[model samples]
Target: MGEEGTAMRMVLCETEESRRTYTLNSFGQTISSYEELCYIISGQYLYFLTEGIPEGMREWIEEELGLVLPAEEETKKQLEHIIGYRNYFTVPEQRMLVQKMRTAYLYSSVRKHKMLGDLYLKHSRYLSAYHAYQKSLSGLMQLKTKEQQEVLYHTGLCLTRMFRFQEAKEFFKRSCRLKENKKCQEAYFIVSYMHGDYQKFLEDGRALSFTEEQLSEIHENISGMEERFSGSEESTALKKIDYHRKKPDDLMTRRLTWSMLERWKNEYRREIV
Candidate 1:
């Protein structure tokens, strides 16, 4: 009985070592060499290891190899690169980079489309940007949890640019609820202001419905512009019309409003004989 128990212990020990050996070999397959695995653990080969691997696989590889990988640091660096690319690139350059990233299936491709959407919106190419933003949003939707809030916020920006203000407001509100980020707050305020503007324009036929503070700000801005043009002959010849009086009539406003309302209408309009 003593000899049998000793044999069982020996078998268990061998099985554990074999399992460890298999894990080590699997790590070897993923990396270039045992030396490269050591470099990865030491944070020197992180870029090479992460280049072709998905985000989910990195931790598993780290655990199996008994290595401590700088996954968070690498992610942060990638995000910084994405933001820099967005801020520095021109419209054509951004579009070109987005196209290349998409073709290569790079992890940054979704972010590139999102940044391209913003560039297009800045250039006032609203419809084109909306498509790009939508694609970014779709890519993010596949991710779990609230990881896609940035994509949602950018989609709201695209909708607002396209003059789909109500839809944009809803999207922004949802994004704010999800992430509570500064971008979402800014989008919320813009949507709220635009909603009020659209209502004043359509319902009351008012050029603007400003609060006291907003009126003061607008007056200050106009006064500043007036000073710049004080000596110009063109400024003297310019007629400052009261836009309130010239506000579109109810009939015209209704036509504009109904155009959007018709999109939500369910009935089909048929031709009469």
Candidate 2:
């Protein structure tokens, strides 16, 4: 017979007891013949017995049993309430509850990894946070969503702090490609700045096409940092080399020169503070 005919023949042969056995057996639980009918009846009355049936089959089961199943919405709210009480749970208890929720709600692996990553980040465990973020990204790569940006951003930041700059740059660049996320823009800028290619920084800034206010703020912050770092005798020698290389023909270069001097002054002041 054809596939559809075979399926129809199987359906026609299924009695109510047989349907119940099918559902229970699909979950791999063996039911003794003596207890099967009683178990099926109990499952019908409590509505707890349709564990393995797909959602489309649910309507068929309800029609055959002459009873309505509880709406999934109501069941979800009840589960959420039971799991949301933070004060009642210890660390291990909270972890167990999160795992149970993952299974119960059929949360995808990416979501589960992201949740664990966030929890570890909150606790200041950088290595664990990095691992979870990596796992989250691996799973999230299969889906089409903006959530991937968030995972990449966090992973990049963690890797950057861990001094894994090349890997971090990859993530930061990926994040910047995704639409107008201010955090990603800032992260990209910071990573470029750290690489110390001033020309690249200027090029990236142009590519980002920041607003006037953003450009002004970035200029001011760079000036402030240069001033702060340039005050020392050691910094003075470094500034002279940077100045020669940059070739101070423009107003911006001159301002950068003065900012370096100011940083030295601030450093001196901090000794007295």
Best by TM-score: 2
Off by over 4 Å in 1: 1-104, 108-112, 115-124, 143-147, 197-273
Root-mean-square deviation of each candidate, in angstroms?
A: 22.0, 21.6
**Candidate 1 — what's its lDDT?**
0.45
- Give Cα-based local distance difference scores for all models: 0.45, 0.52
What TM-score do all the candidates reach, one by one?
Answer: 0.33, 0.44
Q: 101-125 in candidate 2: lDDT tens per residue?
A: 4454465667756766665555445
Off by over 4 Å in 2: 1-105, 141-144, 206-220, 229-273
Determine the backbone clash count of candidate 2.
4
